[model samples]
Target: MALTTDTLRIGINKITDQVDPMGAHLNELDGRLGDGDLGVTMVNGFKNIAAVSDDLPDDFGMACMDCAKAMTKVSGSSFGTLMGISLMAVAKQTKGQTEIEWDRLPDLLQAALDAMIARGGASIGDKTMLDSLTAVIAATTGKTSAQDALAAAAEAADGALIEFFDQPCKIGRARIFGDKTKGMDDPGMVAIKSMIDCFT
Candidate 1:
C-alpha cells in the first residue's frame, strides 16, 4: 500500500500509543547507563508528534516535516534531537509526494539513517540509535511491503541489542559508564525496536 498521509498519521498515532507505556521502562534502562530521562523524552516527543499530525498537510512529506518540528519543540535531549533530524531528512527526500511507494521506502529510510549519523556523529558499534537504525535500513533493503520491512527491522533490532549490550558504549552520555555499560541494552536501540514493532 502507498504510504499516504492518513496512513502516516495512523502509524504516528500507533507509535505514540506503543511508546507511551514504555516510558518508565525506558527511564529505568537509561538510569543504568545515561541520564535516566530517555523514556520521558520519548514520551514527550511522540506526544507532541501525535498532537500535530492531524493538522499537518495531506502530503506525507509535509506531515513528516511537521511532526519533526513538533518533536523538536518538546524534545530537550540529544536522542530526541537526533530523531527529529532524521525525520526531517526523510521529509526532504520525500518532499512533494502524497504517498511513498513501497519500493522507495528503503531509500527514504537510508536517507534518514545517513542524516542521523552525520548529525549525531555516531556509527555502528557506538551503541547509539544508529545501530538499530542501520539494522532497519539493512532489513528494509529490497523489501516490497511495510509489514515485511517492519518485521525485519524489529528482528534486526533484537539481534543488534545482543551484540550492542555486549560492548561498552562508545558514544553519547552512556559512554561515561565505560565497561559498566556492558550487558545493558542501549535505551535508544530499545526505543527504535519499540517504534518499529508498532508497524508490525
Candidate 2:
C-alpha cells in the first residue's frame, strides 16, 4: 500500500518490459507531429531506469534522483529530459522517506506537473503529458490504497488521451503542424497512458 524502493523497481521493470513493443507505434504517432523519437526516448529511458533499479536506495528521494538520472541518460530528447525533471521534483519532495503513503501520490504528481511546467514551458492545456499527469493527480487525490490509486491513475491517463484527441497541440514541435495536429493524439499523452497501464 505504501511506496518503497521495491515499488519503484517493480514499476520501472513493468514499464520497460511493456513499452518495448510500443516503439514503432509511438514513433509513427510522433512522426505526424514531432521528430518521431518519442518511442525511442520512452523505450530507452525505461530500459535504462530498469537497468539501475536494483541499486535504488530505500530513501525514496535518492531512488527517484537515480531514476531521473537514468531517464536523462537515454538521449537529449525533450520528453526524456522532462521525465527526468518530473522525477527530480518528486525525489525532492519524498527525500529521506523509505515508505510514502498512497495519499501522497497526488501531491507527488502535482510536484511533477509543476516541475514539468516550469522546465518544459508547457501548460496544462498544451495537450502534453502534463495534461495527462494533471488528470492522474485529480483522479488519485485522497486515495490511500495503492490499488485504488493505480486504477485511478490508469483510468485518468487513458481519459486524458480521449479528451485531448481532437485538440491541436499548443506547444512543442507539434505546434508547428498547426491545424494538422488537430485530431491527432499527443504522443506524450499517449506515452503516459501506456506507461500507467503497465502498473495495472
Q: Could you tell me every candidate's TM-score relative to the true structure?
A: 0.95, 0.97
Give the runs in model 2 whose Cα sits over 4 Å from its true position: none
**Which model scores highest in lDDT?**
2
Q: Write model 1 residue lDDT over 1-200, tens digit each, in one string.
A: 87788888888888888786787888898887777888998899989888887798987788889988888876456878888898899899888889788778778878888898888888877888888777777877888887887778789888888868788999888888899988888888888887877877
- The lDDT per prediction is 0.83, 0.89
Best by TM-score: 2
Give the TM-score comparing model 2 with the true structure, all chains together. 0.97
Off by over 4 Å in 1: none
45-152 per-residue lDDT for model 2 (tens digits):
888888898899999999999999999997746999999999999999999999999899999989999988888888889899999999999999998998999899
Model 1 local distance difference test score: 0.83
Sum up the clashes in candidate 1: 0
Model 2: how far residue 185 lies from native, Å: 0.4
